[model samples]
Target: MIIDLTTRKVKRVVKLPKTPFGITFDGESLICCCSGKDIQMISCTDFSCTNIPKTLMSQYSYIAIQGDKIVCTVPDDSKVSCLDNGKLVWEFKNESVLKKPGGITIDDKGNVFVVGMDSKNSLMISPDGKQYKQIQTKEYGLTEPSTIYFDKIRKQLLITNINSFAHLYDVSFY
Candidate 1:
């Protein structure tokens, strides 16, 4: 079962905090992060919204569900955080790599994958964010990746290179 938000019937649209870089469901509502800063939690039943944790997170480009944890990509730095109870329990940092990373996804096994602009490869973080792998394909990237997702059943990772292209690749391991 797949629900395409772009073509599907409008469930609802609650206003966001800023540019709304990424979104993920939080049982009762959808938590949308706007421009790496504010988080707006919108009700699934009516799309009503409220702020979660009562504090803005660090600047991030994307967020997604990695098991029960939330994987968030922090900006201006090559680091991603797996958060719990408003604290980062796991972190992945690369000082001399990754540039302008924008999108992220997680597999059913809880492996984390992230993409950045102008690169053919994306970073894959383990469930604990302690280990990482690089996911790449010849046709998929080496460009700008604005959006990305993992297809659980097929074990395929999809990359939406927003510069007028999209691609799919088999991601055997994260």
Candidate 2:
């Protein structure tokens, strides 16, 4: 559902074939990670939806936009992938370590950050998708972390988890 923040009213409601988990805006469209092996692209202007196929993933959890590319987390497969208008570009497979790849956010520099639902750790991949790094660990005290977002205003990385409080990581470190 789309809402008008200033008016505090619902502006539009979109129907989908399956549950929409992760959502991101690519300037002109609302990209929804659909439950059943698909991503829905909805045009902001007309609210028209187009479903794109995801043959590699059984389920989708989170998604992020890095410029014109779409980075999505496939929890069931414990993998992350980059797509160009629905075409595969590059992918990272981590089924051995990452159980359920969950929340994902991309920094302005295009670094991709993703969390694991059961692993209690976050992974960071280079903007070009060549370098992979494990970021958050138990020492950071994250418990079942869920989502992450880069606060452009404050220039920090905001993380939320099962815990009541949210954690803000200084962006400078990365």
Candidate 3:
């Protein structure tokens, strides 16, 4: 559903072939992670869709795009994968660090931020998928964080748990 923020009214609704789990926009199209291991690119103007061939067996829970780079979180596999121009570039998996990773967002520098539903924490991973840091933990009141977003303009991180609580933080990269 497309809404008019100024009027708070629904403008239009575009239907899809499958249930959408995660979605991101890359200037022109809406890249969606759908059910049954499907990825689709839907035209923003016409709402027509083109399927992006599946690269992994696991179901994708969330996705984010930056230029030619596409990143997705696979909760069932407890992993996050990056694709460049539809080719697998890197996959990161560390059960101890990120268990059942969910909602994801990327920064301008290509750094990926994801939430671990099982681990009850949020982590920041390097662009190359080599290094990671647990930026938020259960002690920080993160109980089953489900979604995350990075505000590029304001340089803030927003994280939401499974319930009603939402946390916002001032984030900066050096």
Best prediction by TM-score: 3
Better of 2 and 3 by lDDT: 3
User: Tens digits of per-residue lDDT for model 1 on 13-126?
Assistant: 456667675777756767767663556667777767677573365555677864457777765666677776566688787754455566888888888888855445587877
lDDT of 2 by residue, 1-174 (tens): 899999999999988777778999879999887766577889999999987765333465788886778898888778888888678888888665566888899888788888887788888888767778887865687787888888666778887887656788887753
Error of 3 at 7 (Å): 4.2
Ranking by TM-score: 3, 2, 1
TM-score of 2: 0.90
Candidate scoring better on TM-score of 1 and 3: 3
Q: Would you list the C-alpha lDDT of every candidate in the order shown? A: 0.69, 0.80, 0.87
Clashes of 3: 0
- Which parts of model 2 have CA positions greater than 4 angstroms off? 53-57
Scored by Cα lDDT, where does model 3 land? 0.87
* For model 2, the run of ten residues with the poorest summed lDDT: 52-61
lDDT value for candidate 1?
A: 0.69
Per-residue accuracy of model 3 over 1-174 as CA lDDT, tens digit each: 667799999877867666787888899998888767567788878878787775432554799999989999889889999988678899999998899999999987889999999999999999999999999999999987999999988999999998869999999665
**What are the runs in model 3 whose C-alpha is more than 4 Å off?**
7-9, 56-60
